[model samples]
Target: MSSHSHDPHILCPHCDLLVTLPTLKYGQKANCPRCKSTLTMRWQEPRRRPVGYALSALFMLILANMFSFVNMNVKGLTSEITLIQIPKVLVADNYASMASLFMVVVQLIPAFCMLAIIMLCLPVRLPGRWNIRIAWILFHLKAWCMVEIFLAGVLVSFVKLIAYGEVGIGTSFIPYVLFCLLQVRAFQCTDRLWLWQQVSPAPAIHQPLKVGQSGLSQGLRSCECCMAILPVKQQVCSRCGSKGHARKKHSLQWTMALLVTSVMLYIPANLLPIMITQALGTKFTSTIMAGVVLLWGEGSYPIAMVIFIASIMVPSLKMLAIAWLCWDAKSSKKVDRERLHVVYEMVEFVGRWSMIDVFVIAVLSALVRMGQLMSIYPDIGALLFALVVILTMFAANTFDPRLIWDRSGTFENKEKFDDGQ
Candidate 1:
């Protein structure tokens, strides 16, 4: 009698081996059987119609900037203001510094970045230098756009404005909301990794051994200098002195340092007011938690839940996960590698959504400027809040999740290849 086992159904891209597909839930992933290369079966591809949506969004963004965001009336005084009016008001009011910062970060930069992305994805030919520059601009812009943060700010301001006096939604507000959604849709459509792939030069491919006694019939030939490799398994090459393939591990100390810093910042981020409002020469500051409480008390349960999740829960969870992973790495703990990887993935996935609070603040500040009647301004806490979210996100990205498996020694020697099984 022969003993038999079921074969996996996964196809490894690195080794071109069809292996068993691990039982994965919707968001789960698996590793290759032969090459040990990780595979994500649940990865989402950009939608096909995102380009169309992006174009529509671009139009809406232009319209939103042109029209007024809010129309407010207080005690027989009425004023209508557009989204672009905010910067003009700031500049005219001699708050040049704030105005410049606001224009660049909140308005000009985001608009140009979105426009650049549209240009890059458009079916048009641009000069190589300009194309490359725009591509780089888009890369940086993707991180700084902060549309979600803007949305959150808008909602918060709306609530505050409605609480005090009459507040009417302007034409610009509708388009601005659509613009945010459009930007998200555009991003989902245009795959950043794929765009990067397109702009990057293709790897130079060399002809494989035709009939020579090259003694190179198995593995890959990789450039040690650049790690450029043909996917096949090869022993040694005369050109590059690279041995078996091994990924560089992230420094444990650096990861731990970042995790510690994230933990330290987490306290102040929750405790300190993320936004302060000044009304009638009196200032009111509200921490992240306070804001949640305020919203909950106001019967805005849905928005409160959103704020609780995005601002409070997600950031705290991300920091803890990073810290745990780093601790495991430092202590050389043999924890569940797959589970650890999943946690890391979850952190990365939710990191950006943490900007929801920031978005709310921005939108609110822009919309609820009613002169002496009602003025909305960002508090010092917003800066710290943004910093906490950004720093934690960076920490999550910097700390390699592979360290979890490396410390566990669960990874087999990747260089070992059998000639005859």
Candidate 2:
């Protein structure tokens, strides 16, 4: 039984096991013994590494926006689209929502995240609790930074365009790719635990904690935003001022509601045309599956599979997985807790990739305009499909993975389960 204001002990966010963090050397990491979640890692020169990568990433992003991203040649008529023009073209086509999505996920979010990492890691003096506010926004927005996914979408779009004309990478293409890599590396180097610790030391634990047991049993919980371990009864985090629960309150109900709404949107997203092609006075509307089939039939096997997996298979299976997780969390039947935990992690990891199709549409619509000879325009279905992806992502976030380990017969303390802590 011991306590410290800056405690070395941590509660695993996934399984809630309390463990003492060891002094990790360079390139070493600590994992939770219970559910195999990576708790923390010690990177080589964490401060300098993230700051450098973020700075480079921001520079690359600037270059990406300044020049052409891709060029298409058809019958000696050429069209080139810049990275910044993607959203503007979508807006011109009257698809404001899809345009906003593209702008936010592809550019704004990644840029902000990189800047946040730089500010936090560097010795910058911000005025009046700005650090805490920035840190909060940084961690929350980190998951939504989809630059890498957008890059993948761009590659798929290029492959799809190979049949229509000679598709070539433009001046901005390599810079954007480098931007994606640098931003991801910068994010990986900036650890949430480390950042929160910089903002404020972790709150003290006044009670005894068992190393190999659940935090709930010890009346403790981890803040989702800052990873600060605190008493279960404390609703707001003392360190980061974030409101949290031992588990997400009514997590199942909220997740189920979002899942239901997303499922409804998914039906129309599949049925309606996502893209419109205008060529030689003929307009052709294509649904998601139709596009995939066209790509496959045209011998673009890899790109077709990528589209099918990202747009169709991933969303459908993710919804089913979320529903199954809710069931497992609620039911009293003996469930494989570890396997369920793995499934929840996978759902979180793959949920955002579903937006790749929406990005592909943006790229195609922006680059393939030839004034009625050949042009691509986004349809209503693209907006609906984007909404579906966002709704599912929110569903995944609202779901509390810790609940999967909270069922009866899993933990040693039966009273904790009965009390519903």
lDDT of 2 by residue, 264-289 (tens): 99999999999999988999999999
Residue 320 CA error for candidate 2 (Å)?
0.4
Cα RMSD (Å) per model?
9.4, 4.2
10 residues in a row with least lDDT, candidate 1: 209-218
Model 1 segments more than 4 A misplaced = 1-51, 74-80, 85-113, 116-119, 122-133, 192-201, 205-252, 280-283, 366-373, 405-421
- Could you tell me the lDDT of residue 366 within candidate 2? 97
Question: What TM-score do all the candidates reach, one by one?
Answer: 0.67, 0.95
Give RMSD (Å) of candidate 2 vs. truth.
4.2
After superposition of all CA atoms, the RMSD between model 1 and the true structure is 9.4
lDDT of 1 by residue, 165-187 (tens): 67787878888888888878776
Query: What are the runs in model 2 whose C-alpha is more than 4 Å off?
Result: 1-6, 408-421
Poorest 10 consecutive residues by lDDT, candidate 2: 412-421
